[model samples]
Target: MIITAVLPALSKEASIGNIVLSEIAEYKDDKQISHPYNEVKGAVLNLHQFNGHNIGVIIPAYNEENLIGETINGIPEYVKRIYVIDDCSTDSTPEIVKRLTDPRIVSVRHEKNQGVGAAIISGYKLALEDNIDIAVVMAGDNQMDPKQLPKLLEPIVEGRADFTKGNRIIRGYWKGMSKWRLSGNFLLTWLNKIASGYWNISDPQNGYVAISVSSLRKFNLDSLYGGFAFENDMMIKSNILGIRMMNVPIPARYGKEKSKIRYNRFIIHTSWFLLISFLYRISNKYLFRFHPIGIFYFTGFILIIFGIVLLLFWPVLILGLVSFTFGIALEMKEINKSQLRGL
Candidate 1:
């Protein structure tokens, strides 16, 4: 005989802010309940003080049934709206979100599974329609700390930056990350710095971010990259548009959530995307603007190639390297001047 059941049955536990915790176990041969809810920290901010800003949080979820409820419940009361973009989750993710009684929750289900980036774009569009003054992004897996959201908002709230993002590398905050993941993040950070031209920003991969809706209006949202490279692409676009970006030091959180990314494929694809984006940024910001830096970059590339082909012309290679370095230094100086310092 074969049998299937949700071991221990579906149970709901009431928590602070009337958040419901639905503990449902998957049916298996072992009939074991393995899903564990990581205890999310309470909000540290006085919600009333932030009521003036129409803040909206965009949560992009796919197959995140285990912690979706907790993630939603963890959002601070200061946020005026919660846009949960359900990217066609096969599990009970959609149902779980629907069950939440929070009036602030606006569940938007996709007809088919799109990438997380597409999901976030959908939420951004909705936030715009609602005229949200600020938009923040947090993963649906509960990996982001809700309590630290205030930190990300501080710079923007103070009119210091148009874009603010979490940086896990500062002050040993990235200790929670595994060695392999940390190494991969470091590699991507270097590539993204070159691609985005935000030399001052680190940890470009951290998705915990906040941006003013005004900045979002400047972007052609439909043209943005709709994949895991979304964050990196956003940074590149911001730098091109001269957006003021600030980095807030936030700690990394790892719990029962499993990473959906396949790093091998992700690195290859994102690296290529960054390279192309680098060229696009250079063309738009320097060449289109008739900036002399473009000449240095183009000349350096041609000279370096010819110098290598003509092995006797070693002096040409040195000159090309100097030209390229000078162009990069000048670009960095310009970007640094526009970037706002984090509080």
Candidate 2:
């Protein structure tokens, strides 16, 4: 005689261990099952290996005392190093991390509060110094799921991409996100596509990301934007360097954590920075590189300005619009050639 056991449905916030437990429990209830729970869990958790590559996780934290410990604890055992950059947290964040006896943990505290971008940069610098093969960025708020980290690392590990980022917009994974923030993200996604020349990528603002340290060595880290626009700027610079990027579908998790971003100010400031960066990309990638695409963009803008300033220039306005459209199409074609899709 066989007895069947009932298991509760796992929620979106369920961890890998919990999910594995549920699966193992269900299998164990069947008479035909043979694998033990610990064996199954170990198999699921240690699914990925980077050969000899060293993987380092960078956790940029700011007063994340409540959830920081959980975030650090959730990291997989395969990770070689965990760089926690405390941005001068006023709380006991530093103390809590210190209490953890994990030898892999490297605590770096700023004398004053640097922005999140600055903290990540510090981690990147250290990773580069230590010859880390891959560096991943996860928020200290525990919002990024460790279960999905392998998704971000796979593309880079397989030599398919130089950079990989978590895409929360796919598969309705973003349903857990706040509606207002989702709306704002939708607007920025299109804007970022144009500015960064990465028309195929989505969820440009998602901070859960992984980068090949070799790619990091290609650009000047100090030149990157030091605030919320940092991720957007990374996309722009990566496109300029012709770096291949892949988007991994990862679900968004919202718990008791509150966002520190002020979207009203963020939108205004980031939009302006994107515009300037767009002009720079056009100039650097096209004009400086002797590509004719820049002429189309410049002439289009000049004609549009003249068309608006002078009356009876409607024909010039139409020509300007067409020229700009051609430029954008050509740019997208060039960029798409190097873009990689999710697994």
Candidate 3:
């Protein structure tokens, strides 16, 4: 509402485009390609006005020497610094970072190719040392637009949310995304939300995010998995701690950079990760950490026992089949569907 007038200069295309008959509430249709340019402007303004906090950008690159420069140059001047960590890439990424002329840019090199998760953790540590109040993760592949950066960070900056993430599947980018990937993200996202207990979230696999200094300080960084399942694992742990997670929408840009992940394998690996992370979060939050329920393992043990009993002989036995049906129905109500079968 107010953002449209305040951000006239920010995006003539988005503003004028929204006024077009086709562009109004383009987000409502699942096939409209547009970014909420005015929304991004409002978010950037909110970030500046909230608490006077400083900002930092963390870009984790594997072999993205081609597009990283433009991605870096596109960030607004208000952002304090950019940390470009070369995750032991085989390409010329390291050399490109060294040649960059921006004074605010800092580069880190890893001896071996650590996965994206490890690189992000290292960047978080670096930002903590630099005294940055908030840290935002950007991909080495320039798929995410920097104009939407502020929206991802505003919640944490305003002290209204502990952690914030981008939800491309729900955002204006939905139209730009493929049906298969969209389906995969939805299934995994729905599973993660129930398993982790953050019911209000969407787009569980998106990597773009902003985290507060306090949340980062309180997190057990050593416990997070450093590979592809890192973001899901982080949210699982955060949910256990009762940290608020808010998902902001961003424009999806799909281009020449090949997705390192295979879709089928993504589902299997992330499903296992969600189960493991769920148990860990429950154990750590309830048993080892605190007994909010006044019993160390009441809820966890009950759920596990019920699951085991139903799985024991449900296939062949009639009584066991009945128990299994009732048990699954109860759990379906509690956790909802296992995975969203369709996008």
Q: Which candidate is the best by TM-score?
A: 1
Per-residue alpha-carbon lDDT of candidate 1 for residues 1-343, written as tens digits (9 for 90 to 100): 1111111223333232322333342222222222221232221222333637878899999999999999999988888778888888899998888777554566677777768888899888867766478899999999999999989887788888999999998899999999988989999999998788888899999999999999889998888888899999899999888789988999999999999999999999999999889888888989777787777766676778788999848899988888877878888777766652432
The sequence of per-residue lDDT tens digits that candidate 3 reaches over residues 1-343 is 1111111112222334323211111122122221222233211121232247777788888989787777777777777667787788888876666555554455666777768898888778767766478888988888878888778777666666778888887636788888898888888987797566666678878898988877788778877888888889888877666666777888788886668788898799889778777667656655574544313233544554565677854333444345434533453443333222211
Residue 56 lDDT, candidate 1, scale 0-100: 86
Query: What's the best-to-worst order under TM-score?
Result: 1, 2, 3
Cα misplacement distance, residue 161 of candidate 1 (Å) = 0.3
lDDT of each: 0.79, 0.78, 0.66
Residue 211 in model 3: lDDT: 87
The pairs that clash in candidate 1 are none
Model 2 ranges off by over 4 Å: 1-49, 305-313, 340-343
lDDT of 3 at 108: 66
What are the per-model C-alpha RMSD values against the true structure? 10.4, 12.9, 14.5
Candidate 2 TM-score over all chains jointly = 0.82
Q: How accurate is candidate 3 locally (lDDT)?
A: 0.66
